[model samples]
Target: MNDQQNLMIKVVLDNWYSSVKRSDAIFNSLTDEQLLQEAAPGRNRGAYLMGHLTAVHDAMLPLLGLGESLHPELLEPYVKNADSKTDNHTPQQLRQFWSEVNEAVASKFNALTTDEWLQKHTSVSAEDFAKEPHRNRLNVLLSRFGHLEYHRGQVAFLKEKTD
Candidate 1:
């Protein structure tokens, strides 16, 4: 990759790191009971949002060709079903899972070269990737960044309900 491309990758990674840090802060601020409570009366609980983010991030491992997910059991409850329909984990378990998955992902991400980031993700067939080079590993990170921020906002609002 050229210097410009390397710089762009660094910028995106930095932003993603910052967002994850902010999310951790928001999540740590809430009590376990607070996490079980909904941010709004009829909305998903804070615990569900946390678990959902964890499961989604875990899935990205295989999607990005990093490795298999460490928490495959999370897929059915957290990803396949709505929060209302799925069984929620304890806040402690969710917190541990969240930390473990993100740490594993970050380690994998840090080891990747700029060229690797630009390589086609595992989900794309070679023919499709050749036609659409934009469907790369870095693009997955970008999309997941947006996903994390969206749920982070919802979880952050839980602080208000607790107060």
Candidate 2:
């Protein structure tokens, strides 16, 4: 990796961490009652969004060649089904899951080299990645960052209920 490439990777990773930090702040601020409340009428509850984001981030471990998912069970409830169709664990349990999954993923992320981030993630075939190199691990991280931010906004809305 050249200096420019390394710099670019640092910038992206910095932004990724910033997004995570913001979400973390919002999640930490919410009370259990607030989390169980819907962010908006007819929309998902804060607890559902928390679980969904954690499940998605958990899946990223294997996708990024980091490790197996820490919470595969979560995928069935949080990702494969709608919020209304699924029953969530208590807010405390969901918070534990979020912290565990994110810490594990973050450790794996910190261990990767700049070149590793540019390499193709596990989902893509070598031939396809060769044709479209942009489908790399860093790209996946960027997409997931955006996904986190979207749901974080929904969860943040629940703070109004508390106040």
Candidate 1 lands at a TM-score of: 0.95
Alpha-carbon shift of residue 84 in model 1 (angstroms): 3.3
Q: Give the residue spans of candidate 1 off by over 4 A.
A: 85-87, 161-163
lDDT of each: 0.91, 0.89
- Over the stretch 35-98, how does candidate 1's per-residue lDDT look in tens digits? 8888678888888898899999999999999999999999888788878734467899999999
Give per-residue CA lDDT, model 2, range 55-109, as digits (tens).
Answer: 9999999998888999999998889988872455988999999999989988998
**Each model's TM-score?**
0.95, 0.95
- Clashes in each model (backbone N, CA, C under 3 Å)? 0, 0
As a whole number from 0 to 100, the lDDT of residue 137 in candidate 2 is: 94
RMSD of each: 1.6, 1.6
Q: List the residue pairs that clash in candidate 1.
A: none
Candidate 2 matches the true fold with a TM-score of: 0.95
